[model samples]
Each structure stands twice: as C-alpha cells, then as structure tokens.
Target: MTDDREAIVPVWTLATGDVRVPALAGDRPMTAERLTELRGVLAALADEPIATLEVHPLSDKLDRGRGIPLDAGSPLAQHLSQLITQSAKSSSVAAKATATGENLYRMVVPAKTAAQLGQGIVRPMAAKGVANGIRGAFVNSKGTIVDAASFVPVGKAAAAGAAGGAGATAGVAVAGSAALTVAAPLVLMAVAVGVSAHADHQRQQAITRITELLEQLHDQKLDDERSELDGCRDAIDKATAILLDQGKLGVSLGLDSAVHAIGKALAAADRRLTKWENALDELPEGKAVEIDTLTKSFPGVDDDGGTFRTHLELAGLAIALKRRVIVLQAVDHAQSDPGNPFENFARALKADQQRLDELESSIAGVLERLSALELTRTNSFRPVLTTGEVDRLMRAASRIRKLGDGVMVNSRATDVAIDIARNKDGSVVVFPSQPA
Candidate 1:
C-alpha cells in the first residue's frame, strides 16, 4: 500500500546567527546581473520554470510586539511568501510561513513518509533551525509538530514548561508571577497566521495593478499604429498624384513627339545606307590591259613603232563614290538624332514608379496588420508593434513625400505647383496650387 503522507521540500533556510538588515535605501542601483543571479537561485529551489519574478523592498518596519513581527508588507513577510511558493512548486506539499511578532521567521514543512516524518524533516530541522535563526517549528496539516527551533533561550524554556504543564491550564504557571510565560509563544503563533493572510491579500492586489498597467500600454500602442497607417496612406496618394501630373506635362510639351520623329529619321537613314552598300558590292572589278596592235590606224598617235606597247588602267571609282554616299548618310543621321528632352525627368519618373509600387505594397501590408490588430482589439487581446517597425514605416512615408516634392521642383513645369500649409492643430498639409 502506498503512503498517503505529503513530502517535505526545503524552501529557504536563513543564515545562522544574527539576521542582517537589508539596505533597502542606498545610492547603489540594482544591476541586471544581480537580478539574474537571484532569479537562478530561486528557480533552482523551486524546481519549476519561473514565468515571472519581481522584488520589492519593505518601506516600513514590522511591529515588534509579536516576537519578530511578520506583517503583510514587511520584507520578511514577502520572503516567506517566496519560500512557500518555491517549496509548493517543487513538491506536492502546501505550506505558508510568516515572521513572528518577535521579528523571527517561521515556516511549516509537512512530514511525508514514515522515515521522512521524523528523520527527513524533523531531525534536520531541529538541528539546523536554530543556527538558521528560525524561531518556530515544522508542523503537519494535522497540527502535529515535526520539529521545533528557538533562537531566544527564554522562549525555549517557556515552551518546555508549557509542554510539562499541558494538563493543568494552558501554560506553565511561573512561580511568583501571575502571568504565564507560555502564553507569549501562543500569541506569537496566532499573529504569524494573521500576518500571512494579510500578505496574501497584498500580493493579489499588486498582481492586479500590474495587469491593468500592461493593458493600458498595449492599447496605446495600437492607437499609435493606427495613426501611422493613416499617415502612410495619405503620403502614397499625394505622391501618386504628383507623378501623374508630371507625366501629363511631359506629353503636352511635345517631348514624346520629338523622340518619335528622331526614331523614324534614324530608321530611314539606316535603310538608305544599306541600299548604297549593296550597289557598291555589285560593281564590276577593275583590271590593267595592254593593246599591241595599238592604234596603227590612229594617224595622230605618237608611234615610235606601229606595235608600240600601250597600257590602259581602269579603277572602281563607282564603288568608292557609293561608299562615300553611305558615310554622308550616317553622319546626317547622327547629327539629326534628337536626344530625349526630359532625360532627368524620365529617370526620375522610372525611379518614382518603382518607389510608388513599393509604397502600394507597404500600404497593403500595413492594412493587413491593422486588420489583425483590430480583430485582437475586438477580442480584448493584447496587440503590440516593435519600435523599429514603427520607425521604419514612418521613415518610408517621409522619403516618399520628399521624392514627390523633388520631382515637382525638378520638372520646372509651370503647370504644377506644390503648396505646403499648416492647420490649427500644428499638423503639416501638402496640396497642389489651384489654377486661377
């Protein structure tokens, strides 16, 4: 048969001797490294993954009447609560501890198996509790004492005397004293329980406050994102309008007509040059020839002899003339090549078109994000955007506006005029000048 006893887990053991008072108020700030170390130690004892950890210093001292006072807001009380949480996470045991009215810490770790009931928990506690500065005993759920420790000698004697006098009254009657000393320890125990209850209430209140603050921050972030999305949409629309107007102006200026005329001229010149080259290729080859019977019939011809050697030379002058014509045609085509009227404008337009496309894509993405955020808001879920993403969107919008303004200025066209204005709310407004 399995034992139905609860297992004891060690929560925290205070350092032996005098308890050190924590320096809560000091110039030294808490560093991340120290916090990490503390978190590691607590997590090890808890034996469970820690979701969150927080620490707060006690602003006031505990009441000293009930031994070591374990008030709700005291640092010692908070530490006790931490210990209980740690132990509960590690073992099936449920426990609570608090500071006594005498300013001493006390905890109860339940006894488990037969061997653990006394040897595992009780004996070790009895031997180590006093050295650890703990003034109370480990008790089971049945109110059975597993082990006890006392720092004060007087308290120990009173407790022993109380046990001896259990049958008579409630505590040992002191000789020559009307009041029983054993009553003091019993009052201390009662106050510790009350303090533990109060501490629990305070912890709950703190948790609720923290939750509310986080919710407020989340809502604010959503509001900021919505505002940014509106701004981005406005920028995209303005930029698109500017580019369209510039494109129209370019067409009206006959810039497109000029480019078309030049293209036609170049094509015609190329065809004429090709025709001349073919004609030059078809010309007959030239050769040198000698006529021996020469000109015997020519009476006026100089004749050292009737068969005197006579040479005739023929060169391809027609082919050379055709080649010269082709060269002239090529030069004429080059000189008449009307360059693009709005070279800079064309380049800017291409770049702006690409940027415009990107802006549209970004707008779509942001809209999807906004829709998701809206759904989360409707469902009362937390929605957040990173600071970097927000900044990137803002920068993109700014660049689009600047690029649009540059295109208008560089176009130098009298048809389009950009105007900047400010509303009463100190927000900037951009618009095109109305034609009179």
Candidate 2:
C-alpha cells in the first residue's frame, strides 16, 4: 500500500462493494493518509441538501363536488394524487378515511419519525470490496445517473488532438479524418438514445424498490426500520415533486429507483419511440407495442399504478442528476487559490448551496399543495425537555412520537411497553406501568 498523501486516488472495489481510496489505481491496500483524503470528499457530499421528490400518482381521480369526471391520466391529476399520499403516510392518519370528506393541512409522520426529521445530517462513505465508488443513489429528474464523475465527452479530445499534438504536421490527420467520416452521425445518435433509455430504466428500478421497501418497513419493528425508512421517504418526497413540476411526455419520466426497475425499462422503450418519432419514415418496423403505448393516451397501460408513478420518480431523478452534473462541472472551472484552502472549499460549498436552493424551491411547492389537505395531529406526547443536561434515563422517554394523533402505539398504559424510569434526584427509576 502506498501512502495516500502521494496525491491519493479512488478506485472501485468489486469484492467489497465500495470505493477504495488508494495511492494508485492498481495498488493493493490503501494507505491511511489516502483514506483520510477520501473521507473528506465523502464528507463534502454528505453535507449536500438531501431532497428527493416522490410522486404519488393517483390510481383514480378525486371527484370535485361539481365534477362529471376527474381524469387520473392527466398530468395535473397525478400531482394531486401525490399530495394526498404525503398526508396519508404521516403517522397522524388513522386507518379510517376522512369520515367528513374534509380536506385540510396535516403534518403526517410518526411523532418520533417527524422528530427525527428535523433535517438530520447525512454522512457518505464507501462500501468495501469493489473499486473506488459511491452508491448510485442520488438520481436526477430524468431518472439518469447523478455521480460526481460521468464519462467525459470524447469529441473534445478528438478535436483537440487532430488540431495539434505529436504529428498532425505529417498528415496523421488524414487517417483520423477518414475514421471520423466512416462513423455515421445518425448511428451514433441512435446508440446514444439506447444508452440514455437504459440508464433511465435502471434509475426507475431503484426508485420502485425503495418505495416498496418503505411500505414493508411500516410493518416491521419501529426500532429495526425507522432510520432507513426515513431516509428513503425523504428521497421520495423530493424526487416525486421534481417530476410533477417539470416533465415532458416521453423522454423524461420522473420515476423512483428503489421500487421500480422494470418501469425504467419501459421508459427506455418510450425513449426509443421518441427518438424515432421525428424519423419514422426511415425505420418503421418491430415497434407495435411501444407505438401503442404512446397512442390512445397510453390506455390499458396502468399508468396510475405503482408501475406508473415509479416512472415519474425516475424521470425526476434524471433531471436532478443533470443539474448536479452541471453544477459539479462548473466547480472545476473555479480557479483554485492554492494558498487559500477556502478557495477550493468555496467551489464545493457553492455547489452545495445551489443544490439546497433547488431543494428549498421544491419544498415550497410541495408544502403549497399539501397545505390544502387536513392531516392535522390532534394529540401528541409531551415530555419535560430541559436545556440543561438530562440523564440518559430521561433521554429515552424524551423521544416524542411524530405525527401524534389521539392514538399511541406502545403506550405506558399498555402492557409489553418499555420505559426509562427516572428518579427525582436525576437517577434511573423503574415503574410497573410505562409512562405514556
């Protein structure tokens, strides 16, 4: 292992499923110093405003009092479906529907979950085994990959090399010129479309899986699943909103990556349909199903199903990825002030700021839509929270349930409950009945 201080590098480790910081690409074990440098990079990313938009596509439309029919297939209809989902998911709602058919603002989330949501910090790290790599979790509005590194455009290098360097003067240019000629522009464009669709589809998969995972998590022990579920939920909230606000008919469907991989593949098909839409005259065979999906307003396609909303989330992730890539690349242009570390830090800080700004804008929209739904919490847990140091025993009870309504999950009054009994002298106490 070479010392990481020697201009440390990152490599993807297939065996450990992580990004390994190394002295060089092929080097064995990474030096402690390189690991430290990589940690800084991970820390920088962790500090980003982690916002994910989750679209709640309606399986059916909410009928207006004066309505003849409310269409679920329409774009605006889908937006409303998501707003209802947010409020419903909050721990505030009972299993029963709104008996009054009334709608108002509600803060839906388990009390503890909501409390945990005080926008806690996130820290990114590499998993072990593979080369240097981060989890491909962050996605854009278009459902495309959003990593710090994407393949750089090859055109620039090709052009730069042809103009100058080595033996351009010796007509090394002629052979290169013929090679470029042989590669058809249309063929390359077609290939790009296929690659774009595939990337979009994979992103969809991640979104669906994660969403389905969240639903299942609610059935599990709270202690076992709260933290991970919270993270996934936040991602969905942010990703869904992005797609609802800004998505096109075909090329960009905002779908989540966790619960819907197949949705992405279909989206890939949609992309192919879009690419050939302009030039169907030249190539018009073997696309009957894809063409039908676009026609008749995508009838019988179950667009409002989990399979459908998943695509919307992926599209949103794709767009977000593009924005992130642009912002990250922009940082490279900043002239670093070596004497002032802040200069380099400033570039990174600015990128983070831009991301947060985007998140704030998205949140404002989501809150606006949700504000109309009445998901208010009628009751909640109250604990004596003091500014001064509190005993560890007290800390356990200090946790407040999120989205606390009238009901309590494992109340002190109920059997098989746990509590941190505390004494007046600020010591531990045990009670036969737990405190509510």
lDDT leader? 2
Expressed as tens digits, the lDDT of each residue in 280-364 for candidate 2 is: 3333344322222222332212222232223333334433333222222222222122222212323443444343234323423
Worst 10 residues of 1 by lDDT: 307-316
Candidate 1 lDDT, 170-214, residue by residue in tens: 222334321112221122112222222222222233233333433
Which ten-residue region of model 2 has the weakest summed lDDT?
163-172
Task: Flag regions of model 1 displaced more than 4 Å.
Answer: 1-169, 172-195, 198-208, 214-436
Stretches > 4 Å off in candidate 2: 1-312, 323-327, 334-337, 345-356, 359-436
- Please give the TM-score that candidate 1 achieves against the real structure: 0.16
Shift in Å, residue 245, candidate 2: 37
Clashes of 2: 98
Cα TM-score of candidate 2: 0.19
**Cα error, candidate 2, residue 134 (Å):** 10
The models' CA-based lDDT, in order, is 0.24, 0.25
